[model samples]
Target: MNASPSHQPHPAEWTETQSLLPCVERDLPAGRHQFHKEQLMARIHEDLRTTTRPEPPKRRPNPFLRRTVLLPAAALALAGAVAGGFALSSGDPHGGRTALATGPALTTTVGAADAEGAPRLLDRISLAAADTSTPTPRKGQYIYIESKVASTYTSSVGDKTSVVSEELHPRQVWNSLDGKDGWLIEPGQTGDEGITLASEVVMSGAYDVLATLPTDPDALLRRIYRESDATRDHEVPRDQAAFTAIGDLLTESYPPADVSAALYKAAAKIPGVVAVDDAVDATGRHGVAIAREDGTGERTEWIFDKKTLRFLGERVVVVKAVAGSPFKVGTVVFTSAITQRAVVDANKQVPGGAS
Candidate 1:
């Protein structure tokens, strides 16, 4: 069993946020910009984006990396933060790394979600995934995934707190199948030249790691629960963790076809999983969403094309607002669209052999 991550601050993160405790009146992990910006754009940020979901109902926010629905997902996303260049300061006296580009807080029509619609939608999605072909990376090949990502978080400066969003930006990552080697490039987060991914294996989101998981939905689901145990926030339900871990795999990972199918099937088994009739990605592509509401007032949605059942992107929305929350209902806290995923012959090589 993967035990839940202890609610202790990671040394580096503590160094990053410890001082802000006296100043930040809002709750969040991974320091966000303290800007006067009037709006927000939510992004999954994955291991690439450093945003996080809100904390559970009444608990004091844990600034620890465990702020997101899945700790592993944050860990996977941290791969980018670890292999980095400096963050662009958004006029922070606190030295928080945030982009200067800010946008209006993203909003959406609150799509109706059928409480029981998950299983059926997932089944269709599973069939679609199983029918698709996934390429296996060669020894020197890299898995390139390019996405448009944006994020939202509360920024408190001087007594005024407002929601801020990073402008939608491209995030590109090239990972070796084994997870050992990779590259990351995001303008504000990693800089223009990008950085080498020389960090530890992104255990849950790695293609090689996912390739080894069981394909049987039942078995796969059980494994998911076990692996997700580590990131469990006791205030939050364990099923949310499982759902989130699966969400990480489904979004950031390029799993094998069989594993992909099994993941959708496994997601169907998680309680509270629902199907949203309408949702949009960071790029404005509309799709159906398979979502799980973490009691923490946010619904993490995985959007897929309605016709092809192909995944388009992920969005986290504010469904039920909490007291003192800067977000309103229908507020989209995060969104990411995977524009491309392909097997590249070499590191940092994009599709069509473009570098």
Candidate 2:
């Protein structure tokens, strides 16, 4: 239950979030974030203008820069909406803009999810995670991750209503071991110069904190549930919160091999977790997935490299269609693919310093 919520980045400004400055995917309390999201979503009633909006069904959620999980299912429906929906829709609602192409929101065919295959797949995923190698960020070092992502959300112009998708764009983050100093560069969320990830930095998103967690699956599960209790939305089942929290951890931060393995193994213990054979990450790479549908109308899928079982990224898709809702089944609301992650020596310094 990483309880630090102040320094979190929720999906960029949408209808409800228009007043707040745009940031990346968030991992804050479900009560506040969910309340804000569901309240605004409930207001959607007008039919989407065919000229600007897609037919429906979208995805995204979040990762790398772990923020409170939510969106394009407004974060789950893709950043957990197309970024938590890839964003609550990237950036300002009025412009509905980003470096990604702007037009109709992104949609996709519904991939099949299998409950029976989940556990076995998770087992293999756990082994692969255990064998995976990651650089350790020491003191005076920074954890850097780069992702290609987008968001989906309902928008309006004059009297016309439409769902807009930010063209896919790159999101970069730099976090120090202390979580007190960092920077973020995402077109819709920040300026080209980016913003400091300070003042709001929390231990929850720091690599050092992840290294200290218990590696035993059962014990780790207990720890996650216990920490999540304070922030859990009363409407959400604890199991779902635990699962989403784990998704945020896996997608957004660099975890130790043992801890990563434990997280996967623990995911197997949760009820309702499933597997999808036909899944794709934000990078357009196809692979298997481990997913779960929360109380929200969307499902979150963690994608993996098919051959090596290496984690690629995650996406959110609408599993259940809501009446009059802007999104439909199979809509990819938010999506993110990690193109690079490593231990860098300075804030804002990229891997290989190429970008």
How does each model score on lDDT? 0.57, 0.57
Q: Which ten residues in a row have the lowest lDDT in candidate 1?
A: 1-10
For residues 144-259, write the lDDT of model 1, one tens digit per residue.
Answer: 76666666666566776667665776666666776666666654554456655543334345667767888999998887677556434455577876776676566555678888
**Candidate number achieving the greatest TM-score relative to the actual structure:** 2
For model 2, residues 1-355, the per-residue Cα lDDT tens digits are 1111111111110001111122123212222243223432223211111222332323222233235221112222111112111212212334222333456666777788899999899898888777756656678988776666666765676777777766667777666775546666666444456645443224454667678778999998887787655454568887887787677666556678888888899989999999987776665778788888875677777887677787766777777877787777877766666666677888878766643
How does each model score on TM-score?
A: 0.74, 0.75
Summed over model 1, clashes come to: 13
